[model samples]
Target: MRYGSVCSGIEAASKAWEPIGWKPAWFSEIEPFPSAVLAQHWPEVSNLGDMTKIADAVRAGDVEAPDVLVGGTPCQAFSIAGLREGLSDDRGQLTLSYVELANAIDAKRRERGETEAIIVWENVPGVLSSKDNAFGCFLAGLAGESSELQPAGGKWTHAGCVSGPERVIAWRVLDAQFFGVAQQRRRVFVVASARKGFDPAEILFEQDVGSGSTEANNVGVERRSSTVDNCTLYRFRRTDSYIDDGVSSTLSARDYKDRRELVVMADNRVRTLTPLEYERLQGFPDGHTLIQYGEKLADDAPRYKAIGNSMAVPVMRWIGERIAAALPAEKLSGDYGGSKTPPDQRDLWRTPPALFASLNDEFCFQLDAAAAPHNALCRKFITADQNTLETLWADYLNVPGYVWLNPPYSDITPFVKKASAESRNQIGTVMLVPADTSVGWFREAIETASEVRFITAGRLAFINPVTGKPVSGNNKGSMLIIWHPYPRTHCHFATVERDELMTFGAKLLARREAA
Candidate 1:
């Protein structure tokens, strides 16, 4: 298969896929050092300077539309170490340009009576929770949705799949250490295909259910140490440094000077890793970046930056092998059935009546802070048209009572912030959300909440808006976060069973109705 690559730093994809008989049609890179590296390695392929113009060129019949398109756009805007400005930053805007290029390639290929181009995109995990919802915008563009696609829960899980009218897209977070690399680099990879009966999930997710092993492969290398007077002193460093247990921390472009990991040898001497070592960590050949420029050999500064900004070779090779195997196969059966609701409305599934009845009895909720007329659990509630984020909770509740919120899962940052502010207004607030403790918004909720209760028995079966029946196969666990006006020394933690809650709630409702 021939492929076009954008933001191609040193052409890691080509290096990885070459053994699988995949060729590079062209490369899009503007950086002088990396451009030189690409030219040195693959002199026959052209290097398109800017990515913003590639889409137009393909549409105008100036460039060849390959079978696949791969890129890892600038990720600083969404990186945790950076400012986190998201799509507002000029670099972050390249992500949308990538979508445009993909569309153009697919359109051109269809004109030539060829299958649509497969797309592979890579980025830091921070893009999943960008304040501007950058990931939603990217996914919508690829899937041909009119609006941004919201995640099922308030936050995106480590992996998921979405099938739209145009394509089937799947994403997963993969760590480099698990892919034969000695560095702990976690990246998000998205694979999409417009081919009939082709499921991207089959490429990204393993179908083997019986192999439950989670241990890393043993390299069979002994630890570096020195023996003095029959006493061995193993080499080690402090946790502040990135080196620990023979694994290196993530390599970043800024590691040339700052954030570099240091190693303390058995002799008690300290030193930093060299540029050649950086290449080895990323699975690159030795001196891959050592090229002859205008006058002489390139220096170490640019080599360090180029190697640090590259994709791990071993990880890319695995993905290429999977794609190669599925490229020529017959149409597969059991394709993902499209969602029942539009991408924007999929999060509107209502809370189960029994679960709400059980919680309302204990909290005495008077206002449903986030709900529509049909799904509201309380008599007094606010609807989406009323702008719950801007509406005051006290206005909905005349007396002292709790407010219940099961907010939209697409962008929960605003809802979380609003909920925290409401808790400070002498109003009790109880929020039901996915039990995702790793996100930043969850941390904010925990800091302000008076209590947290995790549902332990099983996942909750939410009520389907269309069927009016419980929806099974819920993937994530649920939790209730409470912020009450009453003073407490510390936040209380507890667990409850779903079966018990539903059973008790049904009996209580029946007795009250008989009275």
Candidate 2:
């Protein structure tokens, strides 16, 4: 199979697919260092330079379209690290360019009566939340329906959208560690094919296939790291589990400057990975991105940037192998069972220290504490073991004081209802729950609570009870629902973003603390 790769940082797609007899026909890149890396290795392949011109180049006969189009576009636009602008930012518009180019390729294939090319794309999980259901529209576009995107240019034109029965599209969040990489990198991979009898879901979603499969029901297996014989294997972060086995944390370009990001033991001595080690973690050849421009490029920052940005070679290879086998193979599309709707981001179970400190008060009663004490402010606590649901309604509905309620994630309606009722009784209560707008309880809290503060610090990282460490992080946004018994003069209910939430919560907590 041949490939035309976009946003081709060091051409990870080429390295990944090469072993399976896949070849790169062209690469799209602009960065100097990564472009040099591509020139050093896949020098024969044409460097297309810019992804925005792919469709035009193909149409103008300046470049030949390949059987496969693969790319991990710039993730910053949708990354939580930046303001998730989705298609609004100029960088975000590149995603639209990708879709447009693929549409153009499909259009050409139709004109020539040729098989439509396969499309594989990758991005951070934040894309799942960007621009209010943008992923849903992305799914629609791949299925040959209109994407309903704005700016007119990003729209899926009927001519570009394929309408036949042969099309199949699927997406899933896959971890790199599961695919034989020794790093805990989780990314969203989307696969689509406009060919008949080919199910992209079957290729991308199936688990424990072929020989020597390590697949299991254990999710902890992904986090499990094994120590190398004489080398110091390391895990970073006080919040992460201290495992006997050595598994490396996810590598980011920014980790070079952050000691906490790359804490490691080499031969029992603490050190960070050399550029070569970083390359190997991503399944790249040693010095693939480095040593390209000789001493001029010897600096590690560019190497780290290139390596971190590239896709995991082994993960892509696994996907490529499946694509190869499934080309002529038969599999039912829907039987594989993947979600068309992106999964909701996981919620942080424990509130962060700063957050807890910012919201604490005197005489606070925790209505829904678990066996594990997650909140420090709760002087009087009700545990799940004590049938807290029954207790909340019958025993303590009118109990006065600053009440902190981090109720059970499931079945929050009754608790929300109780809190709403008790607010009328002049009991001040604050509840933390997922900001899932679809749920009835979420709506109930918003409608009934005196004020709702949407946490804009993105997501909270919760502490793990079993490991006594912090879990990596949860993507699900949280909301603080406040029900003050005394009516406020400013407004009945106001929604505040991160800064406002932090500022307001901190002032209140500080006042109580000072007193």
Candidate 3:
């Protein structure tokens, strides 16, 4: 298989897929250091220079159509570390360029009567929150839907088709640690196949991929960051200030200097990760970036930047393998089936079991029932479809029962609004939601909720009601928003340590059984 990469930082994709019978066609990188690294390592392959010109090049026949196209586009514009400008930012615009290039590549191949190239993309999860629904626009573009980032520019469609969903696309937030990488890096990977009806989720969403409780592959005794600060750095945003688990927090290019999310090691004496260690964390060889690329780039900062910006090698390798396994074939438009899994094959996708229970108490009313209504812990339960907001104001207001909500993540505004209202009106409530303090609902919760308990366990593997299995992972951190009844608010807003919720679930289960 032949592949080309865009925004190719140190060519992690090449390193990953080359070992598994994949050859490099070209690399599109603008940064001098990374471009040099690519030129040095893979001298035989061409450097496509800027991504903006890739489509034009392909159309001009200057570049051959690759079998696969992979890239991790610039993420800062959408990252929390930045202003979150998203697609509006210059860097974020490159994401669209990626899509355009893929469309052009696929079209070029089709003209030659060859198989269309598969497209793989990676980005920070923050892209999901791009301004003016940019994420939705990008998805619509990938799925062969006629859409544009701006409505004023008329309809946008992928090349070569009048467009009736000609491509199959799927996306999921995947953690690198799950794919055998030690670093706890969570990224959103989107895969698109030119072969209509091919589901990318089938290749990307396998369960039980994480190394549960396993220590990261220790490179050597010298695997530590370069930061010399004596102050202990903690995970300041959601959880405590120190790393409890061996998994390193998401490795950013400026993590050593920014010190915003990460801190010095938990121990006062432990140092920051070395440049080589950063490479190791991303599943690259020890000296992958340390090599002589052109003028011998020896600076550790450049190495760190390149490594942090690249896709995790192991994660990409797994994706490549899956793609390879399903290759040498394509079905006609109507011949391909839907993306849903068959009942017989459901076991392959079921998440592993974890500790969780529905608690029944005088103060508890499970609003969103994972199971049947009556099966919930409370005397009253609300099904997912039920509008708990209107009900809370009409019937449940002034009722003393504590509200337990595990609402759907798509839109948590209504749920948060209702929960906050109930809590203000003497009804206690607790919500289990992602630990995203940047959202509007979170701010609303802070105004009313007594505590925003960042779950120390990180992502909670909520059990799937149908199969009685735990979800693979939420792909992000979770938190509990506890709001006590008014006139009893001494500690209005506080952080609950990780251990507080460890036995909390068990005790609630026992209480329900006794009641």
RMSD each, Å: 23.3, 26.2, 23.5
lDDT of 3 by residue, 347-409 (tens): 122111112242323344544322245335344566545656567532633355466666555
Best-performing candidate as measured by TM-score: 1
Off by over 4 Å in 3: 148-164, 207-240, 259-268, 293-297, 329-515
lDDT, residue 400, model 1: 62
Clash count of each predicted structure: 0, 5, 9
Task: Mark the 10 consecutive residues where model 3 has the least summed lDDT.
Answer: 332-341
Q: Which parts of model 1 are misplaced by more than 4 Å? A: 209-243, 329-515
Candidate 3, residue 152: the lDDT equals: 26
Sorted on lDDT, highest at the top, how do the candidates line up?
1, 2, 3
How does candidate 1 score on lDDT?
0.78
Q: Considering only N, C-alpha and C atoms within 3 Å, which residue pairs clash in candidate 3?
A: 224-272, 224-273, 224-274, 225-272, 225-273, 233-263, 233-264, 234-241, 363-402
Candidate lDDT scores, in order, read 0.78, 0.65, 0.64
Clashes of 1: 0
Error of 3 at 67 (Å): 0.9
